[model samples]
Target chain A: MVRWEPGTPERLQRAALELFATRGFEETTAAEIAQSVGLTERTFFRHFADKREALFHGQELFVRAFVAGVEAASPTASPIEVVAAALASAAEFFPDERRSHSRVRQSVIGRNPALQEREVHKMASLAAALADAFRARGVADPAATLAAESGVTVFAVAFVQWLREGEERSLGEIATEVLGELRALTSAV
Target chain B: MVRWEPGTPERLQRAALELFATRGFEETTAAEIAQSVGLTERTFFRHFADKREALFHGQELFVRAFVAGVEAASPTASPIEVVAAALASAAEFFPDERRSHSRVRQSVIGRNPALQEREVHKMASLAAALADAFRARGVADPAATLAAESGVTVFAVAFVQWLREGEERSLGEIATEVLGELRALTSAV
Candidate 1:
């Protein structure tokens, strides 16, 4: 059996975020992050493709939460209803503890146009995956695409609110409220 | 006064697309594309930043359609209604004459990942501008952001349908029809 490296990525990610936030993302090197975490640069590369990837350590988990919600949704739910579940699930990935890290990460991302483009790309990928999940559940055509895209958009809007100062609500609560507003918006048409 | 060059950009764009399609985007060069249209490299660069940009000739006009629709929308219209008008207006940019060129251009864009990222960035910029327009008209924070983002997403989905082989309907018709489906999807919640 192969040796398990428990929590190595988590340690590296925590160290990298602190470094990136305090010293600036461009000033921080992968080797420095690894060294700060008491690991080699080779270990860092093995865990992440690069330092940027390390900051996005939870991206897969973020996507998985959405897919898991889709799978857990009722068979007879409407397309929008299924997407609602996905958003609720995705929000659960952000607890009280992770908010500060996310805020710092967002600031770093906002400072760099390339990182902003990567954020858009990541949302596009999430939408595509959710569309496929909707299709697998027997939803069809524009409904699937529309629901998935809107859910991801709602998540983006609510996540921004969740990161804003003086906002005390949980991500899931904010997402659900925003989703209700979205429903009201579409229904207005 | 500047000299009038009414058709120069159009000519260069067409020549560039034709050359890029035939010669492969990598194999094509700016100087060669300019020569293909009987223009010089200097003239081509004046019109477009580069060869890649020449292929995306109508991107500005496309975004303008969305913004124009926002401006032209009835003041009393709901957020979703305003977005519907925006979709209808955006669809008008893709007339029967432009469909063939769009098909070829999309194929060219699809071949390059970097170009695909550029498209996403362009859409994000378009959404931000639309959000500002909505806010100018008295819409509030999350709603403006959500409406703008959703309208852009709808356009993306409907545009893909418009580009599909053997699809006969105009982009406006398809977009309207898709918008109706989106309304129904959200209402089903």
Candidate 2:
């Protein structure tokens, strides 16, 4: 019988990031990552489909956070207001404790072109998902797409700023501030 | 001495598209594309890095159009105005005659996951380039990112609408309408 393993995925993610950082992503093997965490390659495969999946821990949760936030927003709110609420809710996923890990993860993804492409693909998919949520709330075509993309753009810019060295603001604060900047940008028109 | 082949790349591109649409991209070879145009494979490689490059014939020109538009905008214009100017300039590349070819190219890209990733990566790079242009124009921080991304989002949404079957509006018209929609969304804030 397989032994019970609590937090196996989280533990593997930490080990994989550390090893990928030091050894290089292409140079690092799944077996080495598993061995570093005292697990077998089969266990690693069980937790993560592959090496890259380990690097993007909780991606489904991240997507769900945006959708859940959309669902939980006040029904009377405007599309933009609903998007703002959704972003504010998604910010909870990237708490202060997770900032350092996110920074490292971004750095690792930055160094590799394939990883960078995957990151972009994920963001594109996220925008599509957010657009669907907006449409489901009765928002129309171009408006639904615009609100979703705007939400993603604000969140992306804010997340990068939050990752900057010595930035003390939480992700939510940065997102709120960035959302204001977005409004300021539109005001200029 | 090699004979100067006029419209060689354009010929290769047209041939490649026809062949890819019929025979499938994976089944098609460089020699087949080149020979279809009475040129050699070496000539094809000299013009394009690979088969994929044959498909994205004017990507550099497309990118230059955005940057050029940014540079040509009125100096005192607001960030949003500048982005609108930039997109308006870039829209010149997609004339009525190019729409059908674009539809085919997009269909080819839509069918391939790798091509879709490349497309997303290109958009991300375009956003970064636009942000850099905004920064150089004295637009700061989150505002620069917001304007750049908003411009790209508008352009992207407008592009898809323009590509839709039976759609008659020009890309510039669609983009302007979409920008107005974006402004409306923000006005709700």
Candidate 3:
């Protein structure tokens, strides 16, 4: 049996990200990722299904935070307001320290069609989860889905802007800005 | 040599859609689809890259229409308005006769993850194309992408509603309603 240890997952993730950045995601093996951190491949598999998943760590947590925020928002809040709150909650998952890592992760993902497909799938999943959260709050059909999907699109646009080189804004700030722009655009119609 | 005949593509598409609905998308083969239409497999390949493309025959035409609409919109039209016009133009590609086939196509796509991924990729591509169109018209970043993606989200929500059994509204009408809701939702924030 493998012994469970503190910081093992983090170390494995760090090693995997570094390997993916340096050696390319397709070239980096699970064994190499584990060995880089002095862990067994079994331990790596325990933390992630495969190499690609390492870059998507915390996705579930982010989604949960998003849904919880939407649930906790004032019942009187508008759909966009609720979505904004949820995005703000989800933004906590991407702290300043993770920005550089995320940039590299996105770069790696951008280079591979398989990874790009996975990224789109993740975003779609997030939108679906947010829509479910809206439905739980008694919102109607098209509104619930539209607001949730718009939230994801805002998050995507903001995340890219936040990750840009020389950018100093926090993810929450960028998300707020993007959400504002969406509102302005929609309101003009 | 395969005789490139009129209506061959439409016949192949109709045969493929019927096969996909009756036999399931995964179980249906290109050869079977061609044979069902009384055409050779070579004829099918000349029209479609694969079985999946048969269901998505008008995607390119729709995209072209969208871009052309965006290009032809009044110079002073707002980004959202331009996107709305583009969606309206694309709506012409889905006439009343195609509604039943589209409903079946959506159901088939909904049941399969691979097809769902393709659907998301196609939507993303549409948004990218729209954004590029907006950029070509001198619209700036964030606004261009936001409007384009919002257009896609509106299109998706409206398309599903329009496909509901016994629905009376046209795709354009439903899209306008969804876009109106988006405006109301965003404005309330």
Candidate 4:
């Protein structure tokens, strides 16, 4: 099994995404990924169980930080405000230097049907986590589910816009703009 | 390979859900499904290619109707309004009589990971179809993608509520409520 060391997991993930996009995910071996990153295959196995796992390793921590941020936000904030706070907190885990790599990773994952399915599962789990957090915070009826899913919508839209802009603006700014568009879209209806 | 006649496919689907929920999706055979519905194995094969497909056939028509409705909506309507109109049109296809069988289908599908994955894929496809419809209209930006995804969210929330209410309310009303909740949540930020 690959053990993920601090910083190494992300480097391996980036390397894997690059290789996967270039060589195709099915064609690229874990050994090739490790060698390209100047790490041993054993180390790669240590970080991720397999190539597929590498694409999703960051999501565990991403979910935790996001839910924490939502739970920690002021109780008085609106549901969307709470979700936006959560997204902002999760955003800290991503580095500015890696936006291009992030875009590449998204593209690679997007092209693969299997990877896309797993991505959907990941998003669903994150929405469930957010809903649970909202429920714990006393939001009832449709608010918890609506806020969680709406937050996911905002995240997806913002991330795509961020990719399209290609470092022209900060991630936070893209997120804000997407949220504004969503607000306008919803309210204008 | 199979083809569904007018009413036979829905009957087979209903029968399959009942058997799947009582035994299991994997444990149930086409013969058993057909026998329960007072049909033959050949008849079952005529309506569904296999057991798994019976669970999913309606989704295609549902998605097609959703896209068509979105495209036919007033161009002046906002993205959210367009989504709402599409959902309303889709809801018309799911009458009160189908809700019980639908809930059974949901429960059966929820018990299996493969079925859940298939469900997610179907939903994603529906979202993609909706996005394409939005793109066909004048609205640009990632609005198509955002609206499509948000429409799925609305559908999910509404479907769950409808399931809980057990045919007490029309699907259209539930969908409208879910859309309103989404709008409220987004605007509250």
* Top DockQ model: 2
lDDT of 1 by residue, B88-121 (tens): 8888877888898889988988887877878888
For candidate 4, give the docking quality class from DockQ. medium
- Residue B104 error for model 1, in Å? 0.7
Off by over 4 Å in 3: A1-12, A38-49, B1-10, B38-50
TM-score of 4: 0.85
Q: Over the full model, what C-alpha lDDT does candidate 1 score relative to the true structure? A: 0.88
**Whole-model lDDT per candidate:** 0.88, 0.90, 0.88, 0.84
**C-alpha TM-score for every candidate:** 0.90, 0.93, 0.91, 0.85
TM-score of chain B of each: 0.91, 0.91, 0.91, 0.84
lDDT tens digits, residues B124-185, model 3? 88989999999999989999999899888988898898899999889998888888888888
Question: Would candidate 1 be rated incorrect, acceptable, medium or high by CAPRI criteria?
Answer: medium
- Tens digits of per-residue lDDT for model 1 on A1-189? 998665999999889889988898889999999999789999999999988888778787889999899989999988888988998889888898889878998998888676788889999889889999999999988888898998999899999999998888999999999988888888884
Residue B67 of candidate 3: its Cα lDDT? 85
Interface RMSD of 2: 1.0
Give the poorly placed runs of model 4, Cα more than 4 Å off.
A1-15, A29-50, B1-15, B29-51, B165-167
| Best of the two (2, 4) by lDDT | 2
Summarize candidate 4's per-residue lDDT along B61-139 as a digit string, tens digits. 8888898889789878888889988999889888998788788888898899888888888887888888888888977
* Cα distance off (Å), candidate 2, residue A4: 10
